[model samples]
Target: MFKNRYLYIFLHIIMWLGYTALPVLNAIQRDTSKPQTNPYTNPYYWAYVSFSSILLFYLHSEYLFPKVYKQKPIRYFILLILVIAILLVGRYSARINFVGNDINQTLFYINSFIQYLYIFGISASYSFFTDYQKQQSTKRDNEHERLKSELSFLRSQISPHFMFNLLNSLVALNRKKSNLVEPVLLKMSDLLRYMLYEKDDKQISLDNEVKYLQNYIDLQKLRFGDYVDIDFNVKVPTFSKNIEPMLLIPFVENAFKHGVGMIEKPIIRVELQTIENQLLFIVTNKFSNDVQEIKDGASGIGLTNVKRRLELLYPEQHSLKVQQKDNFYTTELKLNLRQVA
Candidate 1:
């Protein structure tokens, strides 16, 4: 506002003109027809009220407000009292010199000081209000930046976590000298491509994400080679809904990592379906007491990272339940999805 010089001057002129017109409006409202009893009939009365008000407001808003903001109340009060005293004298002289009859100095000074102080109060309130708005805007900006940073950090963690688990899968093939390494590497390339290209997106089509999951499952099937029974079911009415990328991988990965080794007739079940913009995913697997969740101190990151991402991205819009019962581990996720336009 201050940078626009013409607008600033125009607004101040309009405001002060309205201020000067107030006494005349008041006199007209009171039916002050006799010039002897009418203060508005005198041109000096306009100066007395309008000039003092504008000067006092400017002084308070510009100089006195800075003093108060800087915690210099003593100097502000002293300078304010001096300015009001001088304006009061000017008001008294205007009344005496113009009307010149039955002039009570005390009452006139008192009323004029009250009016000046009211303008000062108004200026102070304006300063505080503008300052409060700025503070709230700054606070909101800082909060947005913090959330963005946290989500970025969370996204950065996914690539390494995924690479680590995938390397273990490939290592198993190497140890066995299996011919499946070639297909697994090709599938891994596809997964890595999607992960690399789509990691920066806030959301992605549920169709593409589901395809990524299918590729991962296929790779896993190649690695295990019929040793583990994996049932993956997916049902969706449409493919236009959007989901956070990499949000659903952890549970299925967790099942494969902790459910397969050292167990007879190992089984893993994954169910994904969407019902009118709501997504439900369930992963259940058979596990033994000996096949604990901890493996190389990193089996926990998958679930833990997904949980934190769910909280940050979905907030109150999702439900996740993880439990183990009857030697079976299960994780259920219900997410509210965004439909495409």
Candidate 2:
């Protein structure tokens, strides 16, 4: 960082030198018809240029740049006008000295004016750049904070949604005195164990995630037998891998809630496939216009939070698409799996 700073300052000095040299150096070098003059080759001219460059750079770095935040607009405006007027006077004095062939006077006045302008302009530009950078930095920070808050809200909603449905299943079974109650109870208990303990992590083994999803599907299948149909097809390698736990369940839940809730004979299709360093998930649900109005989650949140989570966790590595046409709702998600591995 320090090296970069030095390089930046060195470059700025070179830029000012180049700008100043353009008119003066060209006029001196191009006047071939004039007699040999020692003024062009004088050491005094070089010294003046060097001194002016250093002073301007120091003013910009030490005072103008740092003082921007402290100065009110009215005060700053007044200071700028004063500096401009001083620069004009200095330039006039330098021009007269040069006309009189007084090298010392010319250098003192002209170089001072040029240096003042260079520093003032450069400082203003530098301050503008700094303000731009600060604005971008603030925007990025706000986006990060928003994404974090959204993820927290989504996760909270997911926990309760899973529990609420499981409890309903248990309650229904208890009312009917069904023989499947005991096994379903055990499955629910196991699922609760995973949700409570394992899901605290940001990620879990792919095998474990698949197992939990299977159990969840089985539990739901027990509730709606012939009236509902579920087809889950997953093609994955038998390798040790990890995934964001419960990430796919919300899509599945969405299907069950809308697809099978009001339809006479609803079909829910889910497919999961992983190849190399990517995971693909596609869920399609059949719903009718007769279905009940979509209900927001407990805290008046919806799938927007899920979308936000995908952005934060996956960023450029994932793609999500929602398509609604006629009576079908389909969601497609493709995630790059290499990072988790």
Candidate 3:
């Protein structure tokens, strides 16, 4: 899982503050020595130790680990040892200058070596953890981009195929010299404009998407006229929400493609309802059992593409159910719009 960077920073700040203040708090509680004799009482010694620890931690985390450790592990270990030795020498010199010659030199050196090891270990662990997190984040971003590009290609395929079908409908109308042809052409123009311009957006207003769907239904109404029974109802209280562009059209297109021709009393039903952040969509169409079995690569490509898109884009945020009972094919989709993005 991903962690909030601000929260990580806040917790690290609290830890560092505690680490810096604990020694001073202990010295104050004991109150056993004059400022001139006690090393803990000397502000300069505290400043040097605190600043040196912080500087070494960042140096390893930001520079040494990234630039050296991954490429040259043995060299990095040698450099680490050198850094610890130098820090120990500086610490011993500070102790001699500030704490006087009465202190046990051997015991001080041992304690300082242990302290340096502790500091180095903490810095190394933290650096490795942060680098691992960065690598994971980069991998996720690259995968998202790949899925997005694939979805765009799938949508492009749908547009040309849909346009070909629409043009066929227009040709049929031209032969009959129907009065509805002009209106159908007008609606088709609007639909094409939306597909060309708005479809490229990552998302568009739900209201606009509904409008495009209505235009598509209207165009089909002109094509079939009174021969087919179609019911399209939309009950949306708000228009502020957004959805993936061209996401819903394929289902509706699939319904009209296979549901109407060579069937008695052809029927297609579509309903859309939105309550707060949840959206429910249903589409049901009648199909003739006598018709040839629809191949996956034939009229079912749109449905296949849509299923993959939903898995890539929404994942756990949406549910889709497709069922076939009797001579009717039904699809129901429930989407949690609030989970988008």
Candidate 4:
């Protein structure tokens, strides 16, 4: 609310104007007056009360509230008593000029004290509420920036692993002087271009992501040839949905990395489809019990990295499960396709 300067000021003016005009409204509404007329009806008394209320409100809000309420509670109580005494005495003095000596001073002073306290309390509460709101907004902004930085770092980790795998494929082709080298290098160029550009976006069309994956698979096929059997199937909506970039490739990469080496008749299968505005993807690879996971500093950002990205980007909108059973390693993911704010 405080973010808009003009609106906040206008609201403040409207509220105080209504409060200041209340006595005049009451005076106009009265059909008759008592034989001993009340001081509240007098324009002078009304003007004096309005000034006092406004003064008390601003004084506490601008000056005393921060120091007293935030820093020293005991001092606030003591200073509050002084404030009440001073304002009460001033109000009583102003009343005498209009009301004369006939009124009870003690009762008037007590009532004046209560009214001044009411204004002070309102001012303090308003200030505190605004400050609290600003603090919470700051915390949320900080958290958002923190998450953004972490996500960028995770994406960076993916780049080297991807480049390393593609480079290895190119190396194998170049060493053998294969005719497919040029085409594979061209495919790698497309993949590299997409990684260099599209990976930075918060969201990209699912079609683009699918194309990227196809390019990666083509490179892998060009490298492995008849030695490995790989199948990739995709069914998606005609109207493309949005998805986080670099989200689906790591699992398929893992399949290609481990499923082919020294294993008999190696096979890797990957399938993706959208049903009822939800994405379902599964990657399965046949693995020999003897084939072990290779660990290195330049290795692919594995399941843990992808899992964390899923938690951050999709939260409750996604589910992931990984299993090794009956000599097959399987990773399945279900993700909501709805847009998020």
lDDT of 1 by residue, 1-341 (tens): 56788896898799878878878778777875664477776777766778788888888887777656369878878888888899988888787788675767778778888888889888889778767887899999999799888888888889999999999899998787578889899999999999999867469999989999999999998988789998899999899999999999988898998889899889999999999989999999999997545457765888888898888889999998889999899999999999876
Task: Tell me how far the alpha carbon of residue 265 in candidate 3 is from the true structure, in angstroms, after superposition.
Answer: 2.2
Candidate 3 scores a C-alpha RMSD against the true structure in Å of: 3.3
Candidate 4 local lDDT, 1-341, one digit each (tens): 46788898899899999998875666656736552365667778778888888888877777677767679878887887787788788788778887777778788777777788789789889879877888899999999999988888888878887787778768877887588898898998899899988888578888888999898888888888878888999987643688888899989988987898789999999999999679999999999988677778756566668888998898899999989998899999999986433
Task: Name the candidate, 3 or 4, with the larger TM-score value.
Answer: 3
Model 2: weakest 10-residue lDDT segment is 35-44
Which residue ranges in model 4 land beyond 4 Å of their true spot?
1-31, 34-36, 67-82, 175-177, 339-341
How do the residues 95-118 of candidate 3 rate in per-residue lDDT, one tens digit apiece?
777666777878988987887778
RMSD of 2: 5.7
C-alpha TM-scores of all predictions: 0.82, 0.67, 0.87, 0.86
Write down the lDDT of every candidate, Cα atoms only.
0.86, 0.72, 0.84, 0.83
TM-score winner: 3
- Models sorted by TM-score, best on top: 3, 4, 1, 2
CA lDDT for candidate 1: 0.86
Where model 1 places Cα greater than 4 Å from the true spot, the runs are 1-23, 32-37, 40-63, 66-68, 86-102, 292-294
lDDT of 2 by residue, 1-341 (tens): 99999998899778767865564676567775662353433344444544554555555546655574366666656766665565556444444444434557656566656657766677668777776788899999999888778677777777787787678767876776587788888888888898888886377877788888888888878777667889889898753666777888878877876787558779999898888878888999998886567554542233555676777788898999989887789999998774444
The lDDT, on a scale of 0 to 1, for candidate 3 is 0.84
Of 1 and 4, the candidate ranking higher by TM-score: 4
